[model samples]
Target: MNMLYLSVRQGSEKARIWQICDELLARNGVPPSGREVADIYVAEGGNQGTGFTQYSHWKKEYLARQEQAAPREAILLSPGTVTFRSMSVTADGTIMLPADIRRAMLLDEDGRVTVSVVDGELRVISPMVAVRQLQRRTRELVPAGTLVSDELIAERRQEAEAR
Candidate 1:
């Protein structure tokens, strides 16, 4: 029944009780049990029923706040973009991708990554994603209905004839 004689302002007894509960929980990084919180409230000039009810409501809100603040490994970013800063690379040349990036890149199939350096930045790309990017770029650069393979073959034939 460790408690403090806290001065409660007029009409702010509930706030004072909740503040006491927070301070009690924050002390030593280990929360007191429900009975302890209720006992402390009683020691602070509050009745048993109000103390227990206030402590219960305060506990629920505290847990909800903690859950909301917890970090999540998987998160959504803008389309076609996943970014990480200051990620560690092991001495054995292994880099662990975050869960959101892995999910966005569809890395679950074979877990293969194509590593490349572009513009002095390390890039880890999925094989299928890389191929899709290449196809999209080629389509943007080449005209429709143009046979690039046939043109390459014709140039090869002319070079052989000249030789």
Candidate 2:
């Protein structure tokens, strides 16, 4: 048997204390204090300090996770709605992209991207989009019915004859 399972046979003590706290809050609609959990833990032959410490640590981490998940949940609940969020740039000039924006940009695979600034706004273009834009521009510049390959061949023949 795993030594970790032998600790509680169900879950960690932190989970147990959190479940207890949640149940108490649901029943009375009021949050329980550390002292109340410590008292119950002591009565059950567990350490009072352990109960309070576990509850405090679990609550802090759980709240942090919930805060981080809120944005993702909103994106899932409402599709096609724009989500404007502020992100702090790291000291190393790294700006983390959110999951929704990454998915919209089709950046599922790691590849080179062309980053440019136009009108004071940063633009990140994937290779596929960049190539399409280049193709469109080339078509506009080169008029219809102009064979670039034939022109190159004729120029090469003229150069060869002169040589």
Candidate 3:
């Protein structure tokens, strides 16, 4: 919340101009309004300052950085489409999948599953399906009838069994 007063350099009064610009800049894609700008001004602790003067230095700096910004390093959150459902870990540390999802995945109560995190969402897959998927993907990547391919398939099978 570091702030600069435009009036300070001029030895005059408050700094409203930069404050207006900063609020406008901070609004990202939202259409502008006087209320939104005033809200931003108040939210940035503007009311505390003398004569309500000055804009946030961070806001100005943010715009500058955005102008020359590199690609953002950010995580992709899964689309939260799973509705009317919440799960808790059981005493045995296993979550019982919902009836809908279990039916969709064609899973039985006694069936074994491979659980994985993809795009921050929990995924449950059948081990056989997983193995076949791996084999298919491996075949696509590695040429057939290679010693390395055979070894990799064997290793993957072993790992899958161990899980």
Best model per lDDT:
1
Candidate 1 regions with alpha-carbon error over 4 angstroms: 1-79, 118-120, 144-163
Against the hidden reference, what TM-scores do the models get? 0.36, 0.39, 0.26
Q: What would the per-residue lDDT of candidate 3 be over residues 19-127, giving only the tens digit for each residue?
A: 4644454555422333444455677665545322333343334445554554432211111124556679889887767655554453423366778898998777854
**C-alpha lDDT score of every prediction, in listed order:** 0.65, 0.62, 0.50
Candidate 3 least-lDDT 10 residues: 72-81
Q: How displaced is residue 116 in candidate 3, in Å? A: 6.0
lDDT for each residue of candidate 2 in 1-163, tens digit (9 for 90 to 100): 1111123335667657766666665666544666676677778777888998876654455445555767764422112323777888799988887766664553423434679899997887754456556888999988799999999999999999999
Model 2 RMSD in Å is: 22.2
Q: How high a TM-score does candidate 2 get? A: 0.39
Q: Pick the candidate with the highest TM-score.
A: 2
- Provide the global lDDT of candidate 3 against the true structure: 0.50
